[model samples]
Target: MKNYVAFTGLIGAVGCFLLGPSICHATENGGTVWPLGVQTVLPAILPALGETSLYSYTAYYKADSFKDNRGDSAIPGFKLENFVQAVRIVHTWDVTFDNGVTLSSGVIGSANKIKVDAFGSSDTDSGFQELYLTPLYVGYSPSENLHLQTGFGAFVPLGNYDGSKLANSPTGNASYTQEFDLTWFPHPNWEVSVAPTFTINAKNDNTDYRSGNVFNIDYLLGYRLQSNPKVQLGLVGYYTKQVTDDHFDHGDVEDGNRLRKFAIGPQVFYAFDQTSGVALKWMKETSVRNGPKGDSLWLEFAFPL
Candidate 1:
């Protein structure tokens, strides 16, 4: 009877959290989430995070096999693999109004490396990827257990880019993005979180080409070890889909190049304290289309200032 009651409570908690969040999805160019839930514990903890420190995180992603627009394996002639490493540093501050609204604001900057290799072909590329801003973000908490985060910013085209090359880092144009993250903790030891992003791509002046708009979602479901609350283990995943068609020549259809992909894996996170932690995650790509078909490995470290 006690077990049944606990299970019912778990289901209720999960349902409450999931209803407001999006699904998990893969991506960066394509998109992924490091997780706001992974960083906070109790509801009040949010204010502390914003007020006490700057957060620094470093993560690496390794993937192979580029999927074409149809989500099929890449065209018959080329092969692809990618190793991308990124570093992000963020600073945030919190405000709590008398009306009981808690607001947090922050900014993030990142540097990345994207390496690609192609087999059965002559295309091979590797080097400095790029540098960009993640988001100048603002977050709101309506209740102790629920937080909503949003980032309205652009990724600067400061990376290495070649208009003619398929493997370059920059899109050759600034891409605007609005990022949304919803975090919920129904129990002291468990959490459910999601991040969804909407992106608008600009025309590449160098190539006279414009890519499609993108939507990506990332998810995390976690539980802290009862014996060691700082150690968290769970499932992490993401999905990304292109909603618009790529057009060139001022909206003339060049190609309906849309993409879709899904990936999921086990993740572990351990925090030494409220100010420091490390995480490891591995995702296996599945049901992919118009994207890469392979696995990704992520190792992350978080530092709070």
Candidate 2:
């Protein structure tokens, strides 16, 4: 049976929205469009030929501190909470290349609710974020235990956005992303994977502020229980770094205001059947620079449709 799994890019964009409208003005951090820590299990695996599946994800993020360039608390008395829900639909075509590569396509839709308490005031907003479309995704299995994947996707601004609000919409900007991934089954019970992604941003016409490009790496180490092969326990993590400088209509912002962060935590997955499962994860952020520092909880479900 083909174990189908897909990416849910929800939290990074949702969290960026909670950071307020002025991404490069108050906090010395550049915003990003890729959701961190969302790809925890079976990241590089693809569905079987002619298979279709649906993946749903829910995430909650909370932060009480905004780190500065020096990684110190930049915003005092700052607190933020965000809830995100996203759905992904994936379909793998029956066609296979002579080189043993299969093709797939997917789309993602998301909604978010964000609340911020800062500067002795509180603000909240809730709405759809963005629409992500993956027109081209490729997968290859060189061996029974090794799988590789690559894909391209674009984000369309389909949510609400207001430059004046403290809690704005995550769909304020459109972006494009490319990703590469690999999964290794070192043993029948052990799985290890690495998925790295890069995102390029477009100018937010509302603010005329262009965020820098972001590079993120997500990794996983999991072990399936012998007693119950349906249960898997793992540690999942990610590292995010802004590679380019934030830009205005004129030029790059001073010092770039690059954002960087690292997170790691525990995750558990329970398989109800060969093609249906539920996953839960908690990620604690650390080594943050020019960004919010906090933790996030994620619940995800995957099933064949």
Candidate 3:
């Protein structure tokens, strides 16, 4: 345990440098929590068999995005509508200790392509983006049935960002995110997991715009069908609310602004074998305020090594 503890700090610094400069902000170009499916969260549990384990995963998501309308209700140009597709890959490595605790870290990069339709014509924006970097993670199990995880994810400026857009989180400002995760297995076939997170943002030096701090939660509840590890059915959901006010260098926005949304959906997953697994989920924003109101779907694939 002591040796692994020392190793964690050693590797953490290297991970930070490899991930690139820290203050860049390419926030939610696509959205949060891997599109919400509890059945498929990565590193579902810490491994006990090896010094380290590698998990490579891919997720794709689509969403409808829009901004506040400003004109005639009958005119379609009154509001801008956009459809965004994000393809992301996240690589994470976990190191296990003699005491069974695990330390995980990873980097995520993505390609986002958005199509905007307005006034009977459409324009598009596409670019490769640096999404996020998880510098460290600590996992522990206090009981056979309970698992806990704590980590911080730094939101860097790795994506294509332009401050002129009506609304885009990824193209916004830099932020530091903190996360707390808990999973419980009350019965052999039942499991529940929840992760709550908070984010703090810094002013965008390029545009002097600062998005509000945010609070969010990701949750999942699952039950195995029969007794096989090959298949499981579950429910997943997420809630995101901006707790602080957004500000701009412009004097008009000095008062600040905020946004919030909630969503829920279903999840299904299956393991092809011990080496690979896949899951599918969909979440529809049931309510929204000062934020994009739409639905999102996620297709997740994971490989363990």
Candidate 4:
């Protein structure tokens, strides 16, 4: 585990240098037009075993739309539409040593979609659509208070319209991400974490899609209601920047645009008991420059096997 962490750090640093500083500014200030959907919410429900046990697998789905204001159409139809579905199964084999240290590992999977309609057209020629399995990763928690994770994944497009479709589709680019997170509990009811993540694209189609290197900084703050262990609330926020030249798989587009996104939202979790629970979460993204933006809603139910 230690060796893997070190290797990830080295690869991230090298990717940053190779991409250069111009790539950092292209998309850094805009909202994520490509709805990655809710990656953080609805994770596997951790079992209360205090020992090794198979956690609960959860399923989730969300649909969202965004209107275009580009002013080209008398009435711009819904410019962006997205649908996402995912299933995650987690098993934690925990070992507690005499030093009070605990170790755990788990895996996750997902399927997501992003569709954009043409400005004023109703046919398939108007825009592009992509559907792909986006998550396949392993994570580890060194202690209840600290977590670290990394994974390799691929994204493939389901449909494309114009020559630019590949560049703009959500699943057009394939990449690997390395993420590390740390959480600390200062009190019985409050917990916080700082996570830094890096993404490297193995393929980029150029056009509107630029892939290279990106960095994300995430913050999570949660509080458990003093009166009920069954209820808890959390606030999550994150900022991400493209750290290298946005590389396009094709050859005609510019390579120096920056991309950045910021989001904050509330999450609620309800525990029915030791083996079951429900969750609700919501978030919105606003365009800072010339990027796609939208909002999302999610509901999930989980229970042990």
Candidate 5:
């Protein structure tokens, strides 16, 4: 339980956008709570009761152009590069509920640096971003092989926002999110997991533009090598879609503003002990629309405190 639960990956604080706030309404590009390509391996597992752990992620994201609704380049010379470092801490309660369910809560903090070059505009910004608070996270292992977890959280806009800059703030305008994950181990060394999240955005008081609802799914299929049980190799990926239309002044704006993307990559994990490990992965994005087509690289580490 300790080994598996230590991989309860959270990408809750990685949603800051590299573009300015006005782009959210002009191009229908907005930040999301569950960023693509950043979820953990065994996301459904939870730390044992009374256990606390820390997870840190370092990520780099780059995109050369923006895509329109037809999947064509809308901004040919647009370029963006972003780097983020996030730390999350989760603590499982000492009590267990009926049906042998355990409970945990967590918080995440992140700092980001973003640079953008496009439309004859170049700018860069770096600062601490938002705070993500997870008040309740529930975990249940029906058997030794199956785990399920769910949680609720919110993003607090802690960073400053200015509508005039080409490179904007790392924090979003604020949002609420719900997350769910399922992990199943078919064999002793085989793992399969899927985690999905939905976010409801708040109106950006700075711009009065409200983004649409966003949904995302992250998945992993991995196997531990018999020759080296400490090493695991797998495939990881994500899919995201905007489920609703954007709004302004409490009115719906149905202007083909939905965003979508899909990405897949390879992952490698090494366990140093029962409760400590590190993972690295790379994701290449395709089938993108109304957003940037990019690639992301991530290095994640987790351990007990």
Candidate 6:
């Protein structure tokens, strides 16, 4: 069991780094709660379950500073403060039929808040609260080393400032998202996965707003150390692109359109057993569209219920 756990963790960590955030089928641990910092890596390990049930929880705190083109601070003395705080709970179950096929499904809910301070004055300057429920569906090891999953989710806007009081009134009236995930373990110690996501807005009342198409991609690649399985490390990257010319309506003039962002970093993980583990990760993003640029740091601890 210890060796299996270590091997699983190593495969998961390496797959996560090579594929970025896209590898979900190989690392799901039924019901477990993860510490705040390491939650970003949670999606990478969802495929490892086999005829088991699990639960997990995760929380995060993030801060970012934005810079504009020519590598200059966009807000100058007023550093546009960007931060995200969120918590999520997940439940997973795996079912194997007599035909040697397995299916897994789960439920996930999250509460998150995003804040942007263009002037570094107060938290009240710009911020919004979001709540969401996601359906988890996965197919595991149809053959020997492959997995696939797909789902649709919605994001509800809980709170936001009025258009007249802000600079970049960037709040989703209501949004729906569709996602697809693919994972492949060509070998026991090497893994890779990819996730591509599309989001559409149900309603957009803000002025200066254009289309509602948003695209996001997550990739991970990881390798186990000495095939020991107890520990592993890998690289992770994420990319986001907006398909339309969208602008925020902040009482004043709106800002932002055709935005693109890419981030790359490292992720490390250690497992105590089949039901417990810890992960630490960091990522930095640069805007290709002269928008805001920043980095994120995270730590996470997870244990199965």
> Best-fitting candidate, measured by TM-score?
2
lDDT of 3 by residue, 1-305 (tens): 00000000000000111112221112222123222332235324543434333433333333344322121122133222323233322233445467657666655554454443334544455555335567777778778788777777775655545544423324444567776777788996787877777778777665565666777777778887876856878888777666776554554332243545677888887767654566777777655554344555665554544
* TM-scores of the models, in the order given: 0.75, 0.92, 0.73, 0.62, 0.90, 0.67
Tell how far residue 238 is off in model 3, in angstroms.
0.4
Which ranges in model 1 have alpha carbons more than 4 Å from their true place? 1-64, 100-109, 117-119, 123-131, 134-136, 250-255
| TM-score pick, better of 1 and 4 | 1
Q: Candidate 1, residues 1-305: lDDT per residue as tens digits?
A: 00000000000000101111111111222322222112222212233434434444444344455455455555334333444444444455455566554444434444444444433433334444334454345556778677776666555555445544445533355667676777788898888877777778776565555567777677778898999998989888777677877655544442464657677888887888766667777777777654446565655555555
Stretches of candidate 4 off by over 4 Å are: 1-78, 93-109, 112-114, 122-170, 205-210, 249-252, 274-276
Q: Compared with the true structure, what per-residue lDDT tens digits does model 6 show for residues 52-98?
A: 32333332323343333333443433323323344444344556566
Point out the worst 10-residue segment of candidate 3 by lDDT.
Answer: 5-14
RMSD of each: 10.8, 2.9, 8.9, 8.9, 3.8, 10.7
Error of 2 at 83 (Å): 0.4
Q: How many backbone overlaps does candidate 4 show?
A: 15
Instruction: Kindly report which residue stretches of model 6 are placed more than 4 angstroms away from their true locations once superposed.
Output: 1-83, 93-115, 119-122, 125-128, 165-171, 206-211, 247-256
Q: Which structure among the candidates has the greatest lDDT?
A: 2
Residue 37 error, candidate 6, Å: 13
lDDT of 2: 0.75
Residue-level lDDT of model 4, residues 88-133, one tens digit each, is 3434345445653333443333333444443343211212233223
lDDT of each: 0.49, 0.75, 0.49, 0.41, 0.73, 0.43
lDDT of 2 by residue, 129-170 (tens): 878889978999899899899999998877656665666546
The list of candidate 5 runs beyond 4 A from truth reads 1-30, 250-254
Q: How well is each residue in 1-305 modelled by candidate 5, as lDDT tens digits?
A: 23222111122111224333323432235346456666647888767889998888788888887776778876547788878778888899999677989999888887777887767768788887778888899888889889999898888866776645666545446788888889899998999998888888887675566778888888899999999999999999899898887766644454646878889999999988878889999999899877777888988888898
How much does candidate 2 score in TM-score?
A: 0.92
- Rank candidates by lDDT, best first: 2, 5, 1, 3, 6, 4
